[model samples]
Target chain A: MRYSLFVGCTIPNRFPGVENSTRVILGPDHLGAELVEINEFTCCPALPTFYSTDRVTWLVTAARNLVLVQDKNADLVTMCNGCFSSLLKATEELENVNKCNFVNAALASVGKQYRGRLVRREGNRSIYEPVRVRHIIEALYTDFGREGIADRVRHPLSGLRIAVHNGCHFLRPTTRTSVDDPAKPVMLDTMVEAAGATSVDFPDKQACCGAGGGIRLQVPKLANAITKDKYECIHAAGTDAIVTGCPYCLYQFDHAQKDLKVHPIPVLHISQLLALAFGVDAEHLGFEWHFVAVRPFLKKVDAVGVV
Target chain B: MTPGGAPEAQKKRSTENGSSDAKSAEGGPLIVEDSVFTGAEHDPDFVKQIIRYGGKDVQTCLQCGNCTGVCPVSLKTPYKTRNLIKLCQYGYKRIFFTIPWICAGCHRCHEHCPADINPAEVFVAIRHIEVREKGVPRFIRDSTALILRHGFGAIPSDDIKRYREKEGMPPLPNTLPGYRKVLSELEALFRKTRFTELIGLETGEGAAGERKARERGGEASK
Candidate 1:
């Protein structure tokens, strides 16, 4: 139940609410999952921009973060889809003997080694273990199933309609990350439903939020155009809010709605929703930091007597 | 595969047609030189490098339009993922300099690719080649610069800090101790891989210098 929380770069800086809500919900008083922070961890280096540009450096950097978690002897749980994919992909690729040797040589220059899967002798026997990396959503879904999560909800979000965005890297490159089915993902929806909210099944539910691959930062017009499509679909679904597991997607939906001049709808991370359902104060969850105001959604949640 | 291997009949027709004045309506047909097929142009090394860089499924690409059909950016941009894959497989590395940047990395293409090509990863490989030879795009440079300076890609500003504090969270949560050392080590690693040069950090010579160096290296290798 213990994990080295990997809050990637964007979540901590751009979306502190995600970090705050995750900590609050997973704190000992709540779900009670032991969340440890490894300060040595740097950016997941972001897959599309950094990892794509320099594969060797990306592997080494991701391996360095993994090594830090290994130092803690804890499984890595990432809140950002980019970080989860980068670290998990690196961990999976480094399992190859040749790739492992290559990355280890690079790591050695940094005074680190990626002994990814290690064997330790315990008395007359040996135990082989590989580092486990999971996205926070997957960790929650697996650790606490629908009923388990529902049992923890003090105030159910009875009538709220939420559109779930699973973000690309969360389910994609499935060969590298088999967290959920790439095409028909239901874990995010399942988690959304567990909070007693209606998980609206919208068209293109699996589409990209347009923030991936640094698109939102670079060619923002195109990014906003893509985001507009997602918004249009969500709006058509008449959802009260958009809920996502990744911070980048949350940022995209939150900011792109304003940039595109679409009617702003509240966007919440799964942790924030869980915290709200658990009767945590809205002010404590950092809703004010959001570009799109969460008042409308908060009012709805409050109307449901969840606040 | 022979260079300038046009049929003799066509050559004679071109000679009779007066190729110099062929563009004029009064003149005969234009003589088009056959494109030379050089071993240097079709580099298997580039293909190998793409696979080496994690585009392991690039070779299995069936040239299906599934990637383009599913690509969201392809609808608005000139970045057709399938075309990029085809070009990458054929060792046309220059197309990747800007095309791959258009990819949003949605993985929709990866999901629908009948060949399991993982066009997203192929784009990543193309981006790797692009960065090494042609320098990274400005957006990538900016992101890398932030990470190098703050140990995070996005730095929380004073306004953001104030907001975070109001939300019952520390201004900077999980600030790594001695991040300066971490940045230095990361810079060293970038230098070893020439990433700093690609992103215009260490040498201050920007991508123009990297492009010039690559052109010179390409000529030398030829």
Candidate 2:
């Protein structure tokens, strides 16, 4: 299956490994999903900054990104939850004729248009459709079922316990994003298990990683405090490391431990874990870029020898 | 319902308090520590304005504590989703300037609110109103300026570029900032949206002028 890969801004810069791992996992020899890159894409414009400042501008900016993906004739697949939230939320808004027309007027200035993908007609009103936006984890869970994921694991990560952090943007605002259960999330755990690791349940399993909503960049003290809370719970669960689909959460879990001077728990993007299970070498996954070292995690997963 | 009914009720309650001290000395908004405003009048249109800005159910909020109980940020910060909504319902416009900025946008409150208030969305609506009234915070302005310049929020540092090269990936992903032509397209879009002006990045002459200033600074430093 072909899809447009949106790495957003953070993954390529803060966590290139997640993007690199995703590429390897979806390689032709592996899951065989073709990723079309739209290099002209910009930041998702992230909700906390753009939406807060000007909702119309945020919607127009996101619609521009969606237009690029639509031109590729492939479904949009985002690696970052922030990117997923921004794009998906804009897509929902653009369905209204007024919003679609308003966004199209702005796109017209840039020599583009947002002809929403799911267009239909009802009575007298023209119903434009929101584009199909999917987070990478959601795509992985749906496109490659658990059995299919299990079949590809060259080195099953048995004996390692991983805490799954399904960061808020991916699951919450349930009415809009129905990717998984918002309250009692099990999809991430199921995906973790598919890679042959035990997905440990922790208190506040669905809490924010404190890196979102400009919390980390703005009020860092509060952000670190929230990160400390998540770490406390993960520590209590006694998991070997944390796994998440969002680079922001992964960034928080990986870096905030060092910032808060708390007990450091290694963090990995879900795709990185899956890449390890698929027998890809650790060196290619960009583990060195991580603030908190993943050596202990590497050894626990038996991927150290390869590194 | 009387058009100014809420304000009339507020005024009557202020007189009923039996002490003129509750009113601000200069007749501005009065914010008693733990009580509803007895002197200041509620901006009767505030709820309608919020509802129009995607806080669709803010009016329907029953002030249940579910949104607060489920808010993870409230656990650490002084931010209470329920209290913020109450403040909005009471039409204390100035409170939006500070209180809503603390929201992490986790949306857990969106799911748990029995009133289906989606307090997180209400916070965004409040933020929108706040931005129009008082401008944005410094970090937000700096971050938006970065996006307008580089086409992304986070500025890529030298270390990140070196790491990307070592990993055999391109130093910069072929994105809006990586390609001049692509960045120009974003510039055109931003121009249409007044993105640069909204963020105050264009001091006098807009983005072109800012680029010239940066170039001058670069030469001076050299």
Candidate 3:
């Protein structure tokens, strides 16, 4: 159950609480999965950044990060969907011999090369074992199934109604992925229910949070407009809070509520929710950095009491 | 429907009405205007560049509105991916620079496209073309510079650092800011990839700052 923890940039920079909660929940005492933190690891070079402007740089940088993961000899587990998407796409691209060689040529300048953990060859085509990149939800859902999660919940959140935002990159470009049904995602919802909260279906459940692809940075008004629709839908559903696996979505939902006229709802990363359900206090989860106060939500959890 | 199916059908409907300004069965004006058939703005190489940059099967797009129907940005903005792809196939290179940047890159259109057009990937190709032809946007340039300098897309603020310290975690996670070797390696990779040049950072204010830092021998090593 050991894996390399790729927090990417957002979790550590904007929300260290996610990193803390993730480590606490998956640490030796909880899931007993050992997380290897490689100091040499850099950003996943998120797709919205270099992948859009410079494909070669994006592929080379991502290949370098994968080289570090391959050196660790463990599957890469990321808390950010953007990281998962970039690393997974890079792995797919690097499977081609020509692209791999081209990236290796660039890597040579930095005294590194991407071998891709070559496994075998088939008719002049080299089949390399791509590094398995998984999102935190996928790791949690697969490694510890719904029953495993339900069995461990010490503080059941019975009265809570959650809107699970799967985030676009987690289940999209659906042709290459099989984690869950992209259109009607149930992994996050089922996990939310496993933790004792009722998962509510919202109108904009599958819509993008409008934070990805530089929309939040470039045209924030449009981003806010898109997020506004999502907020209204979730607010209409009467959910106590919004839960998501992607930091970008969490950031957008948590921060965008300030401008919208809808009621402010607390946004939580899935790890933060699971951590609270697993009996970790709010103080340890780094809820202080959130744009919206989490105190009321904490009080609600307290009122629910232990099951 | 095939690639040319849309225009051919439009031409047939207009000829049946015996006028260029044809009325649809619904008694409204034609959706696509006659100006679209002029090919005055067409640049065939744009489509080839898009295909080269991993925008697969874009030419096979049936001009179906499925992409626009599923696009979240299209819902709010004037950025319809269906129209953008149509323009791309029609070889309107300049149009890509304006509208493609509005894409939020959700990839929903890619998921729902029956033609397997992958409009999201097409948008990325257009973004690359935009960056090369026109300079990177302010926020993108600033963020890319941060990655070049700190080996991360973002840097934690002083308040964020204090919170981390209060929480009994390292103020800085084990990323580039914490390791000079990793930062240097990333800088070398940046040079090798010509990322700075590609993003327009090599010449202009960005380069001057680096030059000045090197002259002072201050943060260049950083």
Candidate 4:
């Protein structure tokens, strides 16, 4: 299926590997996925701004992005969970209740507007394919048949103990979202297994990494405390590596290590881990893009027949 | 979503002789209404989401000074148990930032909230919505700058980084990009919505920078 890849803000400039891996994994599968980023798609500025409750500015920022998606007439795919959640929520709100009209009013000076129509009902651009904050390896298994996926693995990383940190807004948690159980998430864990790595079961794996969602700003102590708890738990699991599907979560776990006495566990995006199995350069995957050194964990990556 | 301070007409009425009179008159019990109260029509569902998200169920509590008396920081700030319930009952927007940031997150209020209000959590959700609207504060421009630019939130300038350094941080890599990256991203979003022309923000920092650049050029030529 054809789709437009809206890389969002954090991915391209900060975590370029996420964009690279998403394109790499999906492109090889012949998904015909296209990421034509509209110039000037800003921060969505969700980091700490979420406290404002000025839904108009936030919703309109999202709406403007949707206008670009609609203009391309392609389902927008994103790699960042925050971007996915905001953009997806805006698309749903605009199309369903039209709550986004006020956002349009706020954006009137920009000469941009959201028409609020999903192409699933039309002949083109199946909106259902818009997996903004998606796990690329999971998408391969779900979208492209997994019949030959294991064959693509250059090495099995079965021995590498891994913890999956699913970011906020990526999963359908509870009744507020649609997909899987938010309270007990297994999607990222299951996807990690397909890449031949053990999804080291850890307590509080589904909990937030303590970034974004205004937690860092609104409640810094709690955010740090919770992140500290996550670090301790992941360490207790004896996991050499931590994996996530969102740039925001990656930033949180990677950064939280700085403030606490947790073991040096390298955080990996699911795509980055999959690339490891596929023999992609750890450096090219933007290894330098990490604050926590990942070489300690990469040494654990299975080479040839060994992990 | 008709946001950003009440309209002049609405503000006139809210502060007018009518609403304040109504607020004190109805001091006994608050009722939800669809037209006015946010949780009016779907009181049960709204209350459930509030509780699920870790907030006080104002529906349960019989207001008492028990929460205020038990609160640790209540004396230092205007925050008290009763004020929280009053705002939740009204769905006041101001709590978006204050409740979370100022509370210091002891959860003592949640322990004391007679109505079972997790004031801390309500503040958190409010802050979440707030962050979605306004950008990060200017003070945190450095921390966010470190995270976005350096790839990790740990830097010597960053609070977390200072902690890590004292704790004997390993030679961590610096993944943060130039500050210009953040500027361009914001400028792009603002440009997308033509937010400047729309909100009349004088086009944000980029324009301010441009103006400075032009002045510098004028000085150079002189």
lDDT of the structure predicted as candidate 4: 0.54
Lowest summed lDDT over 10 consecutive residues: which window, candidate 4 chain B?
Answer: B33-42
CAPRI docking class of candidate 1 = acceptable
- Kindly list the per-residue Cα lDDT of model 3 for residues A191-227, writing each as its tens digit: 8999999999877678889888888876677788889
How do all the candidates rank in terms of TM-score, highest first? 3, 2, 1, 4
Instruction: Output the better candidate (2/4) by TM-score.
Output: 2
Task: Enumerate clash totals for all models, in the order shown.
Answer: 0, 0, 0, 24
Among residues 3 or more apart in sequence or in different chains, the pairs in candidate 1 whose N, CA or C atoms overlap within 3 Å are none
Predicted complexes: DockQ each: 0.34, 0.36, 0.40, 0.09
Report the lDDT tens digits of candidate 4 across residue range B1-222.
111122333334434534434444333223322112221111224345455444546666566767666443344334455556555555444333333444433344554455655565565554444444444343233333333333323222233333334433222233233435534444455445444333333546534433443444344223
Give one digit per residue, the lDDT tens place, for model 4 in A65-123: 56655656455666677666666655555644446556666556556666743436556
Put down candidate 1 lDDT per residue, B1-222, tens digits, no spaces: 111222333345445654343444222222222321222223446778887777875768887788889888877665566766765666645334434366777778877878877787777776777776776676676667666766676656565567666665533533545666777777777777667766776555544444444444344223
Residue by residue across A1-307, what tens digits does model 1's lDDT show?
A: 8877888777766677788889888887788887776667778778866777777778778888888876566779988888888888888878788988887777777788877545687898756455788998899999988888888898899989999999988987346557898779989899888999999888988888888887876668878888888899999999999999899899899889888878889999999999999888887877766899999898889899934
- Model 1 reproduced share of reference interface contacts: 0.64
**What residue pairs clash in candidate 2, if any at all?**
none
**Which 10 residues in a row give candidate 1 chain A its minimum summed lDDT?**
A171-180
* Angstrom error at residue B74, model 3: 1.0
Task: Estimate, for each residue in B101-182, the C-alpha lDDT of model 3 and write its tens digit.
Answer: 5677777887778898889888888787788777676656666777766677766666666766776664464433557878
Number of the candidate with higher lDDT, 1 or 4 = 1
Runs with alpha carbons beyond 4 Å of true place in candidate 2: A118-129, A173-175, A303-307, B1-42, B162-178, B204-222
For all predicted structures, in order, the TM-scores are 0.84, 0.86, 0.87, 0.62
Winning model by lDDT: 3
